[model samples]
Target: MDGALEKSISFILFIIIGIILKKKISSGDETNGLKSLILTLALPATIFIALLKVKVDGNLVLYPILALGFNVILFAFTPFLIKFIGIDENSAKDRSARLLIPSLAPGLSCFPFILEFLGDDALAKTAMADLGNKFFVLFLLYLVALKWHYKNADFEANSLKSKLKSLFKTLIYEPVNMFIIVALILVSFGITIDKLPNFLSITLNRLSFIMTPLVLIFIGLAVKIKKQQFYQIFSLLILRASFTLFLIVGIILFVDITIKKDILIMIAFTLSSASFWPFAHISAVHFKEKRENTKEKTFDPNFALSILALSLPISVLLILGILTAGNTFTEINSILFLGTLLFLIGIIFPIINKIKKFLSKTTKEIKPITKKKKIQLIADK
Candidate 1:
């Protein structure tokens, strides 16, 4: 009966329908085709509308700065966090986790819900936040990954300038970025969405309408993760989220966020799924390592795929649940409890595995002594 409840249910239903249709949508290209539409057409349109609708100002730049700050913080701290999962330092899998855990792909995982629940103003804010995340994942992570590649492959870094220049081109030509720039230019010239010609404004609105359902279904269709890699990625993702919650709590404590929805926007945007761009960087490095015939590789591409596959559902569910709960996570104490709870959940399995190993070792030791004791007693008799 309630509006928010209705929207949440519809989204869940779309995702469930996607999961059900996964069998029919068997090809990767089929999924990619859907993704192409979302990224190039639907998603960009939605973001364009959101941006145009909002008043542009100098203060908006702070969103990207803050988002970039979060990325750097996560990157610095992730090495320590991955150690909890027994991911050996400097291993291929370890490197893959490090590259992924900090990047944010909010378009597919975050924006739809923000639009549906938090409204366009919040979505506009989040779109700005994503700009910083884009730079982190695209340029910074590439450099970091390349450094790792050089370390393991034992080759001097080459063509970095060419690669970085190419990434700059990608950053410019990307459909979302294009729309954002156009929208800003329009806003600067004193033109808002309502001020635009009826034909142009109406078309953008129609395109924005498809973004939510399309994303929800794509998430549904893309939901394929192996059981073996599930636990490790799942735990790490939870820990990542827990840390993000802690950060948001700390920010709210100091920053003056008067709006409740704004806090939710920050939480939801930061909790987005790991970007697919980092995987592209990993793939490129893998290709180079192969050509150079390097024995020690930089990243495990399979491991990276596993991380990305599992990330979407986990982040979607988390953002959805927290947003659905409304102001529940707005308080400091509630968020603290959530962060601590997630942190404990992340470590519990590793702790259990250690206890199991200890018990098995104790049993093995006891069996040998028991056998010796029985033999001695029998001889005496």
Candidate 2:
């Protein structure tokens, strides 16, 4: 099989396996815990190891800065876009989720592709850049977005501080961060493993292989939709896609960024759509909202999942389209094209609802209101 075809097939197989597991499995604390383990531990270690092995150059600074700038721009514009799209004022959590989703590309999915297509050094640089993007989205963007939504509430400050603290603790105490720091130190000191001990290296590689599948499975497991929430979800999706396209095109025009084939691959990865983090944030916000006796609104999980799923296939095709579209589609064109596809997919929630049903069998259970639910809810107060 051809290389691209092979990768595509692998991705499809991964998704299929995920769907099967998700159908048979329940989203209980155990599954959630496993997801956390993969995100906070296995994924980060793989990234750090990959980065540590690669050679760095000036692009190291450039890529991360670009990633951060891209995220900042998205966050700034998402609110206005949300307003223009006419999502209810009470749907701040959903709005934030919408904004944050585009900011979070599937980092794990793109990493291996980066390593393969861009070589070790570019992968290292992209890894650092990705770390910056992750930090900005997870810490800065999320906190501020949450604050904006919860602004009028009496306990907002305390709630914000507590959430920040939790984020901080998670960042600091996570094994991945520690490993990354250690790896960086070793690299800075010009220490090379030359050959990593076979057992250690093998273990790391095994864990790394599991990371992508685990993430995709978690996403598959999280897929959900509601007939009632389709319009709101559709509106938010459109806004996100538009903003993402604007950023991608604007960056290409203003910046002297070269469009290396590797960058093309990275753009494909970055442009593929949002990830599960936004859904997690939505859940957090909903938990807070419930505490304030706000109207109970169900979050459309399929909104983000659909956006992500459609993004992958569409982006791959878009990249191919741009590459083949004569000389007119420059690197900038590729970015804009991919960004626009994401935007379009973002708006098509009805399509997503249809896709979601085909992908997963276990619908999310809407639980009755309880003290636990109240403590966890965070929407319209």
Candidate 3:
């Protein structure tokens, strides 16, 4: 068996263990601690070390540009797409879609697979691409959430300014952002991981190694689906998956694939799970609204939770299919077909309902005429 596949299996088993542990133990605040560890310590260490270790190339520059470009295009269309799909503006579902659609979680979903399957080169490219995604999630999406959050309610100008300032401070002071800055400074000076002090290198390496298992376990613990939300959440996920698949196909058809590694890196990046940043933003919104006693709520914590829970498995499955199928059009074509079908279904759902109602009315009208004819026949006899 392939080493990558073996590692994938092992990672999944650890996730299963996490899920089982969640069942037996009262998670309470421990889940938050795990998430903090992954986000503030583990993931940053991993990304910092990876960036320093990888030899910088021209492709590195192109990768981030492509990643940022993809995000911008998707974000530009998201509001229109949400409106077209009948999601109300400034609503919970709308807010959730806005957050989930543009952001990508390459660190949690794509990085592991890229490292194991495509080797360090591909992983490096993905890490760079994630820089763009990280920016969108941390900065752009926060602004978006804040913008829509204030749309349905009123706030003082001073209050808004204060909130924005606090958000900026939070972003700048974040551990991840700090590490990114450090990595950039090192890159500017042409310093590589090899030149790092041995003690510091070892510490970062040890911290980085915990990232995957901790994140996977966090995902397991976070998974939850209420019976009522199943259909609604599933429909949203299908819509998201369909659109993402469409984007991937567009890239394949138009983008030059001169370098196979670049294409694979692109595919891995594209298939990444939804970022957890959305959940954080939504929870913040909820907390703020509650404190302000706002009756009109635009953010839905449940929707954010559902997306976070389900996106990983969906992303993993898609990435696995791509890797296993040797990145052929056959699997991609299959995804396109499913995506197209889902799109059509979403478009025509109301029409289907109207037609069903019309047919039921016609059947009911015909049944009355048949009864009247039978009565007339009996009277004539």
User: Which candidate leads in TM-score?
Assistant: 3
lDDT of each: 0.81, 0.58, 0.73
Clashing pairs for model 1 are none
Model 2 TM-score, 2 decimals:
0.65
Candidate that beats the other on lDDT, 2 or 3, i.e. the better one: 3
lDDT of 1 by residue, 117-168 (tens): 7888898889888878877986699778867765575335546666567456
Worst 10 residues of 2 by lDDT: 361-370
lDDT per residue as tens, model 2, 1-381: 445446755765666676677757886775667666775666666766665665656656677777777677666666665554445544644554545555655453455455554566655666767766766755565565465445534454457677667557644665655676777787888764455677877777788778767766666665554555446545565556456556555656666556565445445445545554555455545555666565643344445565555445444454444444434444575557656766676556545555776566433333344545886775535
Off by over 4 Å in 3: 80-88, 112-124, 146-154, 252-265, 280-298, 330-381
- Candidate number with the higher TM-score (1 or 2): 1
Model 2 C-alpha RMSD to native: 11.7
Give the root-mean-square deviation of each candidate in angstroms. 5.6, 11.7, 5.5
Error of 3 at 208 (Å): 2.3
**Model 3 poorest ten-residue lDDT run:** 345-354
